[model samples]
Target: MSSQSSTQGAALAPEKRETFSSRKLFILSAIGSAVGLGNIWRFPYVAYENGGGAFLIPYIVAIFCAGIPLLFLDYAIGHRYRGSAPLSYRRANRKTEIIGWWQVLICFVIAIYYAAIIAWAAMYCWYSVTKAWGNDAEGFFYGEFLNTADTVGVSFDFVPNVFFPMLIVWIFTIVIMVAGVNKGIARANAVFMPLLIVMFLILVVQSVFLPGAIDGLNAFFTPNFDALQNPAVWAAAFGHIFFSLSVAFGIMVTYSSYMKRKSDLTGSGYVVALANSSFEILAGIGVFAALGFMAYNANSSVDSVVSGGIGLAFIAFPTIVSAAPFGALIGVLFFGSLVFAGLTSLISILEVIVAAFQDKLGWGRVKATLIVSIPVAVVSLLLFSATTGIYLLDTIDAFVNQFGILACALVMVIVFGSGLGMLPKLAKHLNRHSSIKLGTGWMVLVGGIGPAVLAYMLINEFQAKITEQYSGYPAWFNGVFGWGLCGLLIVVAGLISLIPWSKNSKLEDPEYDQHQQNVQAEAVPETVSKEY
Candidate 1:
């Protein structure tokens, strides 16, 4: 508020915005973003449905051929250009600026609902102490806890149980966002990432000692090689790897934009990729082990109790905790891990939007953080804190992730592959920055193989959607909420791009210019001539 402070803030240079203090911080922050609730709740069921242990084959293949390659692309662009996704894309191809906005908006939409889920984790963290969901976890989650009304539309009917904790979740996220990149986001990941792993290890160690531990591990790892022949199973494998690695969203681009010039971009990508998948395997072991105990108690097989998404985390896991020895302590640790994982991911989502504002409008970090965080917090508190919150979250999440994020990723792959002919140049840029240099194999995977898989995913989803409603939800629900929002996101992104870019914006840093010069000189195709 003082004149000197005001002058300093207004005069802040673009280079002074923020960066990860160390390579360790960068890797951990990215891993935290990728290893969200989905890796734990969704991957186990995806594996179970797609041939259990045999699913690892497709999952690993998808990672090497699709996930890690796209990750390198994101890292190369962000680190080379030192801008948010939109700015970075504009730098790649001025015409593809809208693609960057599209991805950034998708991150914004995801952040809104994602914060609400973290709030649920936060509340469950407290509820664990007394087994507050009581003996019937499912009923408590739908009835007493969420008080979820049986409706497809939004309502003003608020649920105090969900509202208060969600408020705290938003508040905590805002404080961290306001703390700036190194001091807040990176530092928070440095702490929570370790705690999350330690707590999960405790749960897994305790779980294997349970009476049905072997049964659970068998259910998870038991291979069904025949399932690999099914295209749907292979599709599931690609989808899981796509969402799990956080490539489609702008989170990786935004996070990597903060890395120092000499950092190893490709090496860091591999590190984050392995760390994320490693956590998924660890979660499978702990989650299935606990579910094994639940099935044992009910005189059922692991197959009988197996479910995914909210059911696995809120219902199945809680049921296991209540029946296990030392239920309360285990419950606290489990839900606490969810809170940490979800919180770290939520910060990354918010940073994507904040970075966009800072890069385009030349706003300072605090101003950008407050501008974006305040309204989003209000929306989360109001939009997803009602009796119908659970249903609304389900519809929106399915719609946004499938159509919004996946579609953007496909566009990016095409733009880099053939449209702009920049995939070769981007790979060259990556090799320039990384010690472990990539070759033509990286280009083929990202430009050709990756796009082919993504196109198949989009087409597969379209074919299924045309024939039947997703999840057996009402046709009207799928139409209005699912497809309608996907279309709207594109329109909104176009409108966002129409906003006047900051004239005073400076992308003329010597290092930024030098990186571009070297990339163009190395292997840029003759067909690609545009320069940002």
Candidate 2:
């Protein structure tokens, strides 16, 4: 075979020539990606809004029912194929590769907006150091940062002041991606994730010591059954599970594709989920406790303590920090931790697209990293320039978090739950050494109940948004148009699947199988695959 044909043949194989990442590195990278700014900033605000402490029930339920099972599904698919999103799904089932590719595309869009948000966090961290948030910090932040074009009549401008910090974020993300899985992403996570945990623990400890910290903790942990009546609560819980676990974006798949054959999928999945949930719980205790203290100090209601989007981190958090004892030092640590978490997740998202470029386009990994980084950096610079950039960011955040991710995840559940028969096989692969196996219960969750709940949430959310027209929504915010646009994008992506591979060979073509066997024989030792 010619070199080009050989490369195409390997791509068509179910198994390809690739090195397995160390299990330790795999766990660290996955955990790093999961424990992001969402766990710290978004989760607390969302939990407070939905039910304060009440949202935990559905959130935890969603984790086991959907999060854990889907994680295993992604891991199984990636490890089996040893390829990135599109190729992994193509190997598993050719027809569903379109669904997988759509997931990757969503990740790309998310990465663009996500880079902008990361830049915001980095800017906040820098401001904290510069002491730019002077007296009346909250007022200044509300006026200068949170207020939108509609609210303040200021048009967005992409100036050098904002673009420079964004450039830093992009550069940092690229450096991690260029290093590949082990030495770069995994190692950085191992170091930074632990530091984040330590900082959060410190904050939690300090928060519990506050005057009303116990009361705050009580309110957050106590169950409020009334929250169950609101469909928004269920929707928020479901969305959090999907976003927190980093599912449906091809991120988990890309990360897992680097895992060693002998890596423990069940163990890794459980650990990632547990670690992520623990961070949420800890963040809630810290945030609500501080908020409780703040409310007492300001003579405000608990509801007054709640904030969302960038305001939670920049405005609300700064207010809380300023009131705390030794507030400046604490603020620095907290925001610094947030920056670390955001950057870690940012790296993973960027890596997914970079990996796709390298695997499909045959670009060198380093070269692909730089190529993807440039556009991401430029777009993020534009996004940050919106005088209403914060508002625009919030909209994109909701669209991606609430709609895009849910849409992608729904497709994933349908594809794996129905199109692919790999769930049971995956459970067996994951549970090979474990005493506990995800049995019929998991199958029911992934295949039937999970998708049903997702569909219900989507429909109910759409209806609710339609009924509630806020003054702030743009003229273009028509519900039917938005849903149709999303649907069209997904369908267009699926149509791309029908196009034949330029190489004109099926995955099961004999030549491809032979190439895989040859590559496997030469690269991976039999003992490695057999080893635990």
Candidate 3:
């Protein structure tokens, strides 16, 4: 597994893996993944609640201190090893492969429900034109659209509205997955990221022109400098940025694995991080401007109109669309942005799962895409398209994202940075080809600051979730689907990691030989262009 030869296992798997043709595509794809539903819906409220403008202080600190460092950590491993998350970690050191599988499982869980939100947004894009959720947006979203049951239990009673759209979303996802990385992911990001930016910009411009729009913008931008003294506000900045950039997950790792060996790993990371943060700030502007208009219309304060996550996307935004003039345009743009952002993120999440199987089972891209995606699509449809879906989605999302990501990330940096003693090796690998060379400070950031912050976040989340049923969901519901599902993922990850890697995957990575030689030589790669 240490060295690779093209001819070493010709019969096992003949197809060579794909790579992004340029640094530009990789940066675009990475940004597409980072700037997702969270950037649009979550960041605006987080910043508003955290300290308004002052949140940027910790947000930027968290970026340099934690976000970018972990991002580079993912890049160094994936690009240096030139394989999927499992293969990359296995090649790095065998003991660390389980961490990769844990991330893969987390992505699988996220992708399934993530599609439902995208489907909902896609439907809202149409509903915006029709003014579908008339009279009562809240009742329409829950009682009518989702059709909540009296109790928290699964049912076959599918809502045709949700079912059809979700089915369409899954089919679109399946097609994209089958198209392979370059024709599919790269091209999709190429199109969707630009479209998302343009649509959101138009939406923001329109919202800014609305009556009382300045009230929302002022509420969002006016910094409560006093709030900076609160530890929770600082934690909020770190937490939001931690999630915003999509680092330490299997996503960045898998995406980076597709980059060329001599690529500018760090430089591309900085670009992705910057674009992601900038988009989040822009989203805050648009969302709160709309919120300000909503508050003005309702004769209430901006604080009363503020909401985040599902409430912001489905309820609050829908209310804004209904009340404001040119509301239909607002609805289409806002919901349309969600669809674009969610779809791009959904693609990246599924790639983590598909790439893992491709490497582990020695399957070609088409075979792996079909084999991995179809069953997942079926499961996603069954779970998320029914009346019971909202409860399951809410509970599972809280558990996996709030608990799973931080837990896996903490274990990742600790295991890779310490247990395997791979940080020094990884740091060297990064500096060899990257434009901005890393030093001990980067290492310290990844090893020391990253873990401490993650540990603190994990402890706080655990205390909060464990202390009470999350979101006032029933204890049985939280226990089985929340804590129980999280526990199940780790168990599943350990078992999956025990499986033997196929000959083609573990035995045949020709570029990996060049990588090891580069590490041994400790010089710039021969493939490196004069640009560096």
Per-model CA lDDT versus the true structure: 0.85, 0.71, 0.88
**What does candidate 2's lDDT look like per residue over 1-532, in tens digits?**
5999999977865433344357667777888888888888788888877776678888888888778877777776776666778777887777777766687666666677777666666667667655566766676665555344445222556544456667777787788788877778888888888898898888888877877776666666777789889877887787788779887778888887787555677787898888889888888888888777777778776677767556677777677776777666667777878878888888888777777656655566788788877887776667655665665555555555567667677777887878676667666656554435567777788889778877887776566556754236653643323444466657767765665554422344343356457655665544233221
lDDT of 2: 0.71
Q: Model 2, stretches more than 4 Å misplaced? A: 1-20, 129-131, 145-156, 159-161, 228-235, 432-436, 468-471, 477-488, 491-532
TM-scores vs. true structure, each candidate: 0.93, 0.86, 0.95
Clash pairs, candidate 3, are none
Give the top-scoring candidate (TM-score): 3
Candidates arranged by lDDT, highest first? 3, 1, 2
Report residue 434 deviation for candidate 1 (angstroms): 1.6
TM-score, cand. 3: 0.95
Give me the displacement of residue 77 in model 3, in angstroms.
Answer: 0.9
Clashing pairs in model 2?
156-387, 386-389
For residues 14-119, could you state the per-residue lDDT of candidate 3 as single tens digits?
4556998888888999999998999999999999998898888988998889889999999988887777888888877777888889989999999989999999
RMSD of each: 4.4, 4.9, 3.6
